[model samples]
Target: MWQQSQAGWQTDTGAGSVMQHRLRGLSGKLLWLTMAFVMLAEVLIFVPSVASMRLRWLEDRLNTAAAAGVVIDGLQPAELPRAVQDDTLMATGTKAIALRKDGTSRLLAADHMPPQVDAKYDLSDVPAFQSIGDALYTLLFGGDRMLRVYGPIGDSDMIIELVMEEKGLRQAMLAYAQSVFSVSLMISLITASLIYIAINRMMIRPMRRLTHSMQVFAENPEDPARILPPAPGNDEIALAGRHLALMQEQLQKTLKQQRNLADLGLAVSKINHDMRNILASAQLMSDRLVDVDDPMVKGFAPKLVRTIDRAVGYTSEVLAYGQASEAEPKRRRFRLAELCQEVRDILAIAPDSGIDFVDSVAADIEVDADSEQLFRVVHNICRNAVQALANHRLDDPGALRRITLSAQRIGSVVAIAIDDTGPGLAPKARENLFTAFRGSARSGGIGLGLAIARELVLAHGGTIALVEKPGPGTLFRIEIPDRPVALGDWRVRA
Candidate 1:
């Protein structure tokens, strides 16, 4: 009972809004539309009815006048009394009645001279719209003014005319309009109620359910219970609910994965803090191996030292790069060719390494970039190419093993292409090409080099992409442009 009362109040509140605010809710809009359409329909029906009412009223007057004319014409002239004439005029509801017979005007009844006809209507052959328009005109503006109506009387060679007042026609029209309005009001209420109920059940309720689900989901998205339950139909609302549920499920799963990655990063930070000191101590011990005298120890000492140095460098880089974001670069101009030489020299290519390093940049070409970040970007690519070339292990005499670094300055941008003549990347590595810990091509590589290189390159507002050719090697293209020149102190220039 309370729910029913609340619904009634809601309906009344929606309906009782001022005209300016009436069309607010779903129910209110439906009600207004229904009333408008029903009233329009009633108006359509009322005009013709008023027009028809006038037509019938005029016909009855003409018929009564004709009947009176027949009765008076049948009587002798001496027997026609003034009282009978007055009675006939009153019965016909006209000031006068006349019959035109054989080209002669014969008055059946007339108590006085009929007033001048304000309007004339020929009932026998009038167009429909004109008749309707004239009827409306009389109802709106015609007071007690007189009207003349004429029509053929049966098969005789005579026409009947009646002069009557417009008041009766107007009054009848008002009554007819009142009747139509009452019925239209009832129909509007019933139709709007049915349509409002049907549409609310079909659409509004479902939309409300989805809206509530989204609000709850937004408050605490990780709670699985907040997801919307799928509705049970093949309609658009049901489909939308299902798609929303699936999106919430996928988002929850992604949030879980992100939380796990954050926890792992915290754990790795703790381990790296202690591991750095231990690796430092190991490095000191490994340096002492230089003074050992054993032959096997001398043979393996260099390789072991290099491996530990690489391990220490890897740890420091991984920890620094694991920061929330890479630090912004300090920009400066530097020699590109000189930087490439430093990277190649650091790799320390042996005479029998079977890999050729070709640097083709111009000696004087310079780039505006961060020295440390650009060095890492170039070094990582060159080192990866060197390692890839060494991995080929060409025992056959004629196999080509080459890593080439070439560059060109194109207008405002410098385009550098790194080409290698070694084995290309596998499909999985190409798919996750620049992603961290995923684009690994070598065993035990951690896959952070290219990812970090891409990150640093992006920080300089440049792009790095791989270009593939028909040969065995993979090509990486890097383009870095100079920063925009800032306009300073226009007053001084002026």
Candidate 2:
């Protein structure tokens, strides 16, 4: 049983060995991916932005020089102020050129001038007089390397060309890029760490709690209730946690109920052995009732005898249902509708109760089941529904007292649904509906009807569930597998 319970977990975890052994959960991978994407985007945007800003600053400085009466021809090496000359000489040292108003140009600062610049200068004829204006020409040559800014001095015949080296601007941009890259990397690392921690706390932790609780429950089913904590909000994960917790609570309650039922079954097995003898004696006495001439005795004797017989049969069935362990299903292909009718007839519901039994199974449909055991399963459910209706009628006399049994074949499964128009099971009862004594409420009868029904269905490799009913009615559904089985294969081997 433990192996069977652990199989699903093993299958899920086995597929991702790395995930299982290294990273605790998928959140770690997600955090890393998020951080990587953020860092990449920051690098892409920040590098270009810093470069553009530096180029704009250099252009502003050149315009300032031009505005201060720096002309191409008159602005000779000696005529320039020491501060301006020194700054310009140092600034343009990497890639500077001095252009004269006579269309003459000299390389004052560059170690090497690119071929495109000399060719373009000759082609455009180096404008004799250029106006210094607010509008600056911004151009990029060969993949954002070279930025050229050209303008004229106010009312001057000389065009002042200050060739600023891109290498320095490139270096400044590189330094800024490095700083941005470092900061972005740090931010990404921090963000990823925070995301990993937050996700683990908010999502993974609760899931682990749920998984651990389930493992514990599976190991020792008799252990006390251990429920997962409620999620903090109404998000989908929180809702899933809530639902999982509810399901665990229900399962825990069910296991407890089954434990109680096992105990009850043990006790009932002993009592049943003794009760059968007493019932046998009573059957002999009942046989003698036919000889009694009193009309009152005649009318009531059969019912009393039948009731006692049914009680004896019910006791025997309880023992069989509880004690059997993995016995082969005593399956036989039989008409389901006929079996339902048989169960209704055997219950012998009272006329004054005004209870009605309606069967809706198709006539031609058949199912494979252990006739005796399957009969007990159906009889118990139908009897319970009838009893519920009878109980309701005692209170609200006008209430509809009907129990409807419907069966249909859906795919390879045959479903039988029993609905009763009674005050549906109480919330507490519903919570532990199929749990042995746990299903009982204020009005109770050992709470074994549904439990026994479920066990019997499971014995035949089938399922029994409580269907959701809207109001004032209980709906129970039993689904049996439709596969045909040989009688020899189904019978008890011993």
Candidate 3:
């Protein structure tokens, strides 16, 4: 059941990943947006074009009627034969035509009694927006009612008016609108295609290539062939691709180094197991050597036992790596000053050794920690400081060598500081400080001291860092936070 549930969860996660990639794609979205903008521009032009066409159609009728009025009014009467009048009205597409000059109206020509004009429109002084609206109204709601239109004749006081059926005008408007729409449709397609092609060529294709390279690289990062080949341009897309390629190359190199370290760690674990056995037997032998009836053996026996014990501790720490986690600290309240004194005694600094281990931690201060593990932490650090001071003393015996330990509690955590007046750490050592097997300050050192110390500190919910300062010594700070108390449970008990 557990395996089946795990498989189902994996399948769901894979489907989510695929859907995310599809929704994040940019090419299809850009194409649709381009087409939409082009259609919007065409609609803007179409509205005004319809208004202008309607105005022109009305003006033609009025002008034709005015010209025929001149011919008729010069005759014996303002009238023509029925056939001629019918022909004139047919050409103008109006039932009657009239002219107003000097505030007097004259009927120019008529086929019969014209119907009452249902709507009045004066095109002389109207805004463009109003014209477009009126044109749309006629095209949509206009029926067979007569429409009265009047406008001035080119800077003259003579105004021409036409009484015309709206059905014919509405039909003509529908045809004109159809043609405009067809042309606008073609224009929108052409504009959208050009924009889409330009952007896809310059942006989308290059971005797609970069995305594909990233997907392939994520699947198998060790393959150098998966890196993106940057597109041929100086644009943003090209630059992004180039940067991605560089980052992937660096990442691959780092991953390869980590793999080598993994293999080395495995070998070290096996060797550490065998060495622990040898050291255990040696420790037992040293335990029995104190019984020998030799004076030197009696004196050196204790030192030999201490050395073997330290060796055992070192091997145990190394073998602990397979657990993938630090051992849980045995927490108990102990005096901080006493712990520092123990570290001092472990280093066995003599009066003439020129190195001083000052336990400046306040006697009143206490710490909740694993005493043995915490002792190992401070011992490793002070031992390294002693070694450095000893090396410096070989050249300059009078140089001051001091390792001072201090601590203070702030809020919920205690900060312990270790300062050494020996030569400061070199740049190379500082770069990888606290990294196992690589942070050694001196030659022939395995560099595990600081690393093991850091692991122990971290197990106590603490942090270790190199404190930068303007002085001729190195400083390391460790901050250990107290475990959170269950305030709610305490209140309930209270």
Best by TM-score: 3
Score candidate 1 by lDDT.
Answer: 0.82
Give the clashing pairs for model 1: none
Clash counts per candidate, in order, are: 0, 3, 0
C-alpha lDDT score of every prediction, in listed order: 0.82, 0.67, 0.82
Query: Per-residue alpha-carbon lDDT of model 2 for 68-173, expressed as tens digits?
Result: 4344334456455446556655544424545455576543333345555421222122332221111112222322344444555555565555554455654554
User: On a 0 to 1 TM-score scale, where does candidate 1 land against the true structure?
Assistant: 0.63
**Model 1 spans with C-alpha error above 4 angstroms:** 1-24, 67-96, 110-134, 137-148, 154-157, 165-167, 186-210, 223-325, 328-368, 379-451, 471-473, 481-494
Candidate numbers sorted by TM-score from highest down: 3, 1, 2
Query: Residues 5-91, candidate 3, lDDT per residue (tens digit)?
Result: 999999999999865754465755665677778778877887888889998888777777777765665684545678887888898
Model 3 pairs in collision: none
